[model samples]
Target: MFLLEKLFGGKSSAKVNAIKMLPAAYAEMVGDAGHCQLKRLHPALGVFELHFSTANGEKYACQMTACVAGVDIVFAANNRSVLVSPPFSLAKLRPVFDIALADR
Candidate 1:
């Protein structure tokens, strides 16, 4: 089992976790925008690259980290403000980021 699966649980792949966690974190950071894309960073270490466009034609990208507690979630983008209590049902995981761009 991957570290993410152990931490986040469910049948989530690393990429899927990246996608799901990204939106959650982004929502906390930028508010509801309806569309966004989060790229994965290799050697993930619970971190991801976030790219998002707001409804007002603004775009931003940043690095994000994910933290899962015993039913508690504290992500990097939220600055620990948006409290996310887990027992979350994960769906899938895939590689959304360009691994080639990941640092060695």
Candidate 2:
């Protein structure tokens, strides 16, 4: 890994790829869950906890977890098992970010 980093300018390709894939991953994640607000649970850390209300007015939270392997967007209720884990294409990132941020 160190050798790969040294050859690749000190950053693992996996980490760079994952960072490049975040925004679209996040949009598809939040869009699939309907409307919701995302909050970074630990600002200094790389964790984000999403809060959204279900159709029945019940509240649920899901944490966005990312690592060198990849990013996992797990939708779960507080203190319970996972509700859903939607599949997304990492390659779709460029367009998503482009369209989503075109005005900005």
Candidate 3:
């Protein structure tokens, strides 16, 4: 598994655009009780997420989770649960990211 950074060098507008969409994403996520992955004061699934549109044109994302257990990786786009890792470092998050991105 690899990051988009390994495939595409330099930043692009899509990345920026996706970052810009986060507020909407969070609002949409938290607005719906079924979609909300939050638990108490902390988000149960993730905080920072990278949105991606797959080859088939599906909206997907790999989110970085910070829960009581510790930091982990989560695939939580469109309220889908593709993958969730045990407490792992940022380096390990990349591989899980690749899996999440490719699932579509």
Candidate 4:
């Protein structure tokens, strides 16, 4: 089994758990309802878009890529973006950021 599947129950579970693991700050950015969601663009690509809730009407778009090296996270807003590596954990919960029953 893949590490994520073993750590989480399966691919579905991994995706849900990953969305649950979204940083609190990011979750807050997603807005109250309807605005927070995880969209899978392809097998290896996923997108997390959150409402900006600012006067400018800009939005926060987070992109996640599943790669051999691990998942790559990029947060883009207002034409600017920053790369964020998944947090390290001794426990088995690595990120499987994808769409599904995901809460992202």
Q: Which has the greatest lDDT?
A: 1
Tell me the lDDT of candidate 2: 0.40
What's each prediction's TM-score? 0.48, 0.33, 0.25, 0.31
Query: Backbone clashes per model, in order?
Result: 4, 0, 0, 0
Looking at model 2, which ten-residue stretch has the lowest summed lDDT? Answer: 76-85
For the record, the alpha-carbon RMSD of candidate 4 to the native fold, in angstroms, is: 9.2
* lDDT scores in order: 0.48, 0.40, 0.36, 0.38
User: lDDT per residue, candidate 3, 2-104, as tens digits?
Assistant: 4443222223422222323344454443353212122221122224555554334556545543222122223444344333344333333344334434544
RMSD (Å) per prediction: 9.2, 11.1, 14.3, 9.2
- Specify the poorest-scoring 10-residue window by lDDT in model 4: 92-101
Off by over 4 Å in 2: 1-33, 41-44, 70-104
Cα-based lDDT at residue 93, candidate 4? 27
Clashing pairs in 3: none
Q: Regarding TM-score, does 1 or 3 come out ahead? A: 1
Q: Rank the candidate models, highest TM-score first.
A: 1, 2, 4, 3
How many backbone clashes are present in model 3? 0
How would you encode candidate 1's per-residue C-alpha lDDT over 1-104 as one tens digit per residue?
45654565543644334446545644554456534575775433666666766697776666756556555655545332233443333221112222211331
